[model samples]
Target: MRVISFINMKGGVGKTTLSTNVAHCLAVHEKKKVLLIDIDPQFNATQCFFSGDDYVKYMEDGSDTVLDLFDGDVTRVSTVRGASHKSKKCYEEIKPYKIMDNLYILPGNLNLFKIEISAGSGKENRLKKYLDVVQQLLGFDYVIIDTPPTPSIWMTSALVASNYYVIPVKPDPLSYTGVSLLQTIIDQKKEDLDLQLKFLGIILTMVEESTLVYKRCVETIKSTDNLKDYLFGNFIHKRTEIPKQQLSQSFILDLEKSELSYNLVAIIKEMIKRIERYEEHK
Candidate 1:
């Protein structure tokens, strides 16, 4: 299975949108089993798949979430050391919520942010270990992890468990500045952890084609030596329909035929091809 994380050092860059839509496209169009893990403490991805009432109920019921795995790991270690016999089993099989026939989501919770602080040493690898168990017990063709905008323990865990990372950038100067920050983290992690993660590509999102600033921003990004090759050929344009569909909790594929949906489909197809090519070379 291939694991990919959608991340950025800046917020409001549409990382969640890309992650959710890409997973939806792969599952609905390619007929692949896709698991989307929401690592963002804001629970944006989780909200995407459920309504306000449903989400409240899901949270109130204490559904299995990313926090479960992290907290479970700590308990498992304490139990092994004979610290607590009442420690809960860490490797319980977590059944993801089936959003579609082949699409599932391991929802995220706000408590994850707090859990990170109380986590034990070597907790950065907790996500990777949990995914190892998940892959063994319940297989999937692809795993898409959506990370928070800031650099945090949650983001680190996602990066450690990812095979590739995709950065979504807005057509603006501040967002462009975040690219360097992200690259530095990736470079350091690759050496320190000996991770085999690859850069899937930087996708320009929320673009307004008619604006001069948009054109200038695109030019600057494409001309930058470090970012040129990593920039995606196609960009996702800013569309009113996107927010409408999102507020209604509708999948990109299920939306009516439109420019945004068409571009999303194209981007996903390109992503699949890129992954395939990477696998071939590997």
Candidate 2:
């Protein structure tokens, strides 16, 4: 499976929105089996898939979540021993919720914040190890992980487990700073973990073309060598319909023909091409 993470060092840059919409587009339009893993403790991505009442029910029932994979009781064993190993056991235990025909989500929990604090040093590799089993059993075409805004064990684990990552940057100076910080973090993790993680691209979200700040940011991105090469050609413009549809629990693909839907479709196409290029080079 192609594992990708939508990440940013700053919050409210539309990370969850981008991740959810991309997964929806892949599953609904491309006929690909997509698995969305909500690693963010905020559980915003999980909320996107469920209603308020349903979310409460899911939390109250102690349904299987990402927390189950991180708990101390879950241990990993070699797959060479066949189907009776710990990996398969854990995989069977955590049942991902099916949202659509080809879309599933490994829900997130609020308790993840607490679990992350007390987590051991070995926790960084836990997500990677668990996904190994998941790819074998579930066989998804794409796995998109949504991470917290700030750097933490969860973010590190997500990066360690992903084949590629996309940074969702808002059209602002501060968001540019976040891009720099995230780039450094990714570089450090790649060297530390000996990972072959590729930079898919930086997507500009919530863009307002009329604003001077937006123009300046775009100019800077074009002028800067490092940022220019990695910035996606298509940007997501701010639209009221996005939040309206999200509040109504509507998928991007299900929305009426509008600018938001068009942008989402374009972004997903670009993402697919980038992934294909990475696979080719690899």
Candidate 3:
């Protein structure tokens, strides 16, 4: 399975919008089995997917959220002996909310903010190990994670578990500032865990095609040697209806003929091509 994280250090850069739609397209259009995990403590993606009151009831009903994965009493096991082991944390059946035929979601929770983690607790690998077991048993084709817009354990866990990570940047100057800091963090993760995580590419989002600022941002990214090679060729334009649609638990792709829907479809195609290219080169 291809595990990917949609990340950026700056908020309001369309990170959740891009990730939810991409996963929707992959599952609904491309007919791939997808698992969307919301690891953000803020639970922005969870709010987008479900109504606030409904999710409160979901938690009240004793349904598991992403918090259980992190704070649950699942002891760590040293090895995986052919998918059957004493690692109850990794093997226990996790019931993520099923959104559609091919899409399942592990919702984020507000309670995630209360958990305290310490160093050398092997907490970072909890997600990675659990994902390996679940993917093997469920036969998923893609695992897309929506992470918080900060450098935290959740972000680190997502990076540790991902094969590739796509950074989303808005057409703003401040958006570029955190790009380097994120890279520095990823580099540190690589050195510490020897992770093989790859940069899928940078996606330009919340774009204003008619604005000079938007055009200049594109030009600047293309001109910069480091950012140019990693920038996606297609961009997701800023749409007024996106927030409204998400508020109603509707995906852009659900609009069928909307231009915003096709915009996501095109980007999904590019994402697949980029992943294929990496596989060929690696």
Candidate 4:
């Protein structure tokens, strides 16, 4: 399976936006069996996929979430002893919520915020192991992981589980400034975990088309060799319509086409092309 994480250490750059739309388009338009995993403690991806009322009910009903892969009855013995986790009968099979014919969602939980991450907890690979088993049993074509914005354990877990990482950045300098730091962290994680992660480029979000400052920021990003290497050509324009679409908990692609939807479709198309190229070279 092609597992990708929509991630950025900086928040408010539209990771959830890219993650949800790309997953939805892949399933609805591209006819791929897609699994959208919400690993963020905020569960914003979960919020986007389902309505507010349904999400509240689901939380109250105590349904299993991505947290189940790490906590619940799962054990850390595999991490301690260097053994295979599949041999242990620690976890039960988790049923993801069906979004449509070819799409499913493994929801996130607010409770994840409460779970303490210690150095010796050894629960980091829980997500990777879960994805491995699901790939064989469920046969997913793509797994889109929406990660939290931080240097926390959840971020590490997402990196560990992903085959590639797609960063979403805003036009602001603060967001651009963090790109180098984020790259350093990713590089370090690749070396530390011995992971074969490929870069899928950066998606610019909340951009002002006519703003000179925004234009200059884009140029500066393109000038940076590290940033330019993986920067996507298409970008999302700042749209008030997106908030309206999101309030109803609707996937942007499912609704009528707007500027937001148009930009996102272009980005998703580029993403597929880039992934195919990377796989061919590999």
Candidate 5:
């Protein structure tokens, strides 16, 4: 299974949206069995597709919440709550039914935030340990993680678990600094864990074509030696309709036909192709 994480230290960079859309495209369009793990405590990805209100009630017996996993509960490793007998019951109760298939989500909750602090108190690599459980229980074709914006133990845990990392950078100067800081952290983790955490690619999101500032930001990202090699060749342009579509529970391919939607889909297709090529060569 290929484990990929979409992360950025800066918020509002469209990381969750990119992760959801890309994963959805890979599953619905490309026919890949994709598993999306919502590592972020905010549970935006979980709420996006499933019910935000009745998450606790939906969890199965012996299932682990985000908090339980961080606390080192190995028994609940196989206790995932999406698309199973337990989850479907909850889904039926909540209106706005989902059209989901072949895509499994490990729902997140606010309880995870408390666990992050508790786990950070110890020296053990909690995230890596949890990933071993995930690997053993559910061997997936791809595990895409949506992480929180701030640098936390939870974020590091996800990094340690991931093989490929994608950073979504907003078209801003400070956002580049955030990427730099995140890279440094990853490098340190690589040495500590003795793992090759490959940089999949840096995706530029919320791009404004007409703005000179946006163009300058793109040029700056391209000019940077460290990022140039790993940065994605495509950018997702800023568009209001994309968010509107997401709010309406629409897929990327189902969005109103526009240049921006076409460009975003093309970019995601290229990314999947690149990932496949990498796996083939490996």
Candidate 6:
């Protein structure tokens, strides 16, 4: 299975939005079997699918959540939890739903923070180990992991487990810093592990097309020969409605209603196709 992760050192760059929508678009629109693994403690992705009551029942009360896997020896199959009725039922009801025939989700909770604190040092491989179990226990064509914004053990673990990393950067000075921070860490990790990780590309998020600042930043990013290597041709435009829709749990029924959604969907489809081509060539 292909394991991919979406990450950025800075928050509010639409990382979660992109990750969630990409997984949904691939599964629902492309008819691909996808599994989304939420590694962020905020559980924003979890909230996108599950309600509080459902969380209490399926995640809090004796049932397994993502935290349980990292906190213990995840070699056993029992550490992972199955999709809950609430999540399943919700997916069934959402209009213009794009959850593909074989898509699944592993929810996250607030407790993930503590798990990171306890994991310490070499346990960063916990995510990789548990993913091995998941592959053996529940096979899927792809695994998409959504990580937290800040640098942390859990985030690093997710990177270590991924075959490719997609970075979302906003067009601003601080945005460049965030991208640089992650790139530095990724390079360090590559050297430390002596592993080769293909950088999928950087998606510019929350950009306003009319703004000179945005235009200037884009030019600057493109003008740098080395930075050019990090950018994806597809840049995500800033859209107020997208996040609002996500917050309201709106479904993408028709792409005609929102150009942003349409373009985002197109970018995601392009990414999937690119990855597939790479794998085929390999």
Clashes of each: 0, 0, 0, 1, 0, 3
Q: Identify the candidate with maximal TM-score.
A: 3
Error of 5 at 264 (Å): 3.2
lDDT values of the candidates?
0.82, 0.84, 0.84, 0.83, 0.69, 0.71
Query: What CA RMSD would you report for each candidate?
Result: 4.9, 6.3, 6.4, 6.0, 6.7, 6.8
Write one digit per residue (lDDT tens) for candidate 2, span 124-240.
787888788877788899999999998888988899999999999899999876677678888988888788999999999999989999899888877877678888888888888
True lDDT of residue 11, candidate 5: 84
Write candidate 4's Cα lDDT for 1-282 as tens digits. 999998898889888987888898899878999999999999999988778789767755556678777665432232224432222233346777888899999999876887887643778888888888887778899999999998888988888899999989888888888888998998998898898999899888888979986887788888988887778889888877677777777776765667766777788889999999999998
- Model 1 over residues 60-155: C-alpha lDDT tens digits? 554677777666434212222444322334755666788879899999877676664532378788789878888887788999999998778888
Q: How many backbone clashes does candidate 5 have?
A: 0
**Candidate 3: tens digits of C-alpha lDDT, residues 1-282:** 999999998899999999988888899999999999999998988887789788867765657677778776543222322222122233466677888899989899776787887655788788888788887778899999999988888888998899999999998888865687778888897788789998988898888899988877878778877678898888788888888988998888888898888878889999999999999997
lDDT of 3 at 220: 79
What TM-score goes with each of the models?
0.91, 0.91, 0.91, 0.90, 0.80, 0.82
> Comparing 1 and 5 by TM-score, which wins?
1
Q: Is candidate 4 or candidate 5 better by TM-score?
A: 4
Model 1: lDDT equals 0.82
Instruction: Return the number of clashes found in candidate 1.
Output: 0
Candidates 2 and 5 compared: the better one by TM-score is 2
Using alpha carbons, what is the TM-score of model 5?
A: 0.80
> Candidate 2: where are CA atoms >4 Å away?
73-89, 117-120
lDDT of 5 by residue, 1-282 (tens): 777889888888889888888777767776776777777888777666654335555554434344545443223222354442222122112211123765666666665755535333642355455555665665556777898887767677788778888999888888876677788888887887677777888888888878987888778877877877776777888878778876665656666476766767787777777777777877
Regions of candidate 4 where Cα sits further than 4 Å from its true position:
73-92
